[model samples]
Target: MFKKLLSSIGIGSATVDTKLTKAQYVQGETVEGVVDIRGGNVEQHIDEIYLALVTTYIREIDDKKFEEKAVLARYKVSDSLTIGPNETKTIPFQFALPYDVPVTVGTSRVWLQTGLDIKMALDPQDRDYLAIEPHPLVEAFLEAVRQLGFRLRHVQCEQAPRYWQRRLPFVQEFEFKPVSGPFKGRLDELEAIFFVSEHGVEVILEIDRKARGFAGLLSEALDMDETLVRFTYGPSDVASLPQRLANAIGRHS
Candidate 1:
């Protein structure tokens, strides 16, 4: 009775740890991993095992910064099972990564979280930080942007607008302020949003042009939308991407 009581209170309950085949994965690749669990002082019945991919982002409200977590993907990896005292068990799992999972850029991050569900005892969890890399098309596009003399300033994921057809609820923004370019003094900043697929990459760029004179305040008063430029790229365009992107922004800015 004492041992069961102690175990229920998590004094000697089961614990869990997750191991992955690798620490980094491409956004669309499959993630292969195993959850290793060990039973405690008393025999216990575990209801299930859960796994999720999570990331943190900053939200500013009233001059205060609040950190919030975005759960990108999740799954139930295992069913009910029983373990004897001091026994160990392992559950293996494999799942396809979400298409729009945010790649780790600057301070933004992504990771795997594993947890065991049991009735009275506290749930044991394990967290493993993982890196998500951009697709080749996205990598080349960002490189081309940098080549056009834009300084990468900040990156964030914001709520998707009504018309944004995204698998996830949020969209990532890669903000760049021009340092030395024809558009340097003419714009406020340039933000790049990506929708990646197996065949091609779609980009939506928000051109925040510098507000001027009375037009600036009038624009604000009228709730005018920022200029958005949309385009797509594939393997064939790598050679001309830099010039193509520069001209597009120039024309719209």
Candidate 2:
């Protein structure tokens, strides 16, 4: 109990605090935050202050499945800042967020956050997860999906592997509830994978079809067991994603 008690008493340790100006921000928007450093008993000189956006990436390596949390983006916030014993220093920074960012659950499902990485001399990297909000355009696109009768399933983020020549390490796939009613027996599941760039969002709809037992057996024998339909949604967007997806599949089929 005494050792545990002393661990919480600062006990010759240094700490840093990071605070963001806002919890919500849009893509291409500048994010403002402050890094406050508190020194302990002795003086210390920091080599550099850095911030990075970390994301998880899933891929298959050597026929084995694995997931990696990669540093998507990084920026140097400060070069050198010294602090005396028991001294405090505050440094403010502004950074532009990537146009394509993963949407995680937050306040009213509106806030977004990315992990921050800070490296100090002779200490473990000081990391922080800062929350942010979606941009208007991103929110609008999500609303369109909801309007199309698809419920949110889950969001999975992964980095595109070498096999994926897409030049993107991080990919966010948003799974949706299956289109029900008449379509319930037709399709297995639906997913909307968004690849956002500076210009707009690249929406890809993946439809998994449920096959009959006989047909399934035949396809499996032929080494083709599943059917996946892929399509792209563009800037001139449609209000209903399900309807649009149906049309796209129809035209392609």
Q: Candidate 2: which stretches are off by over 4 Å?
A: 1-14, 62-64, 105-121, 131-138, 159-167, 179-182, 220-242, 250-253
TM-score per prediction, in order, is 0.88, 0.74
Best by TM-score: 1
Global lDDT scores for all candidate models: 0.86, 0.58
**Shift of residue 76 alpha carbon in model 2, Å:** 0.9
For model 1, which pairs clash? none
Clashes of 2: 6
lDDT top scorer: 1
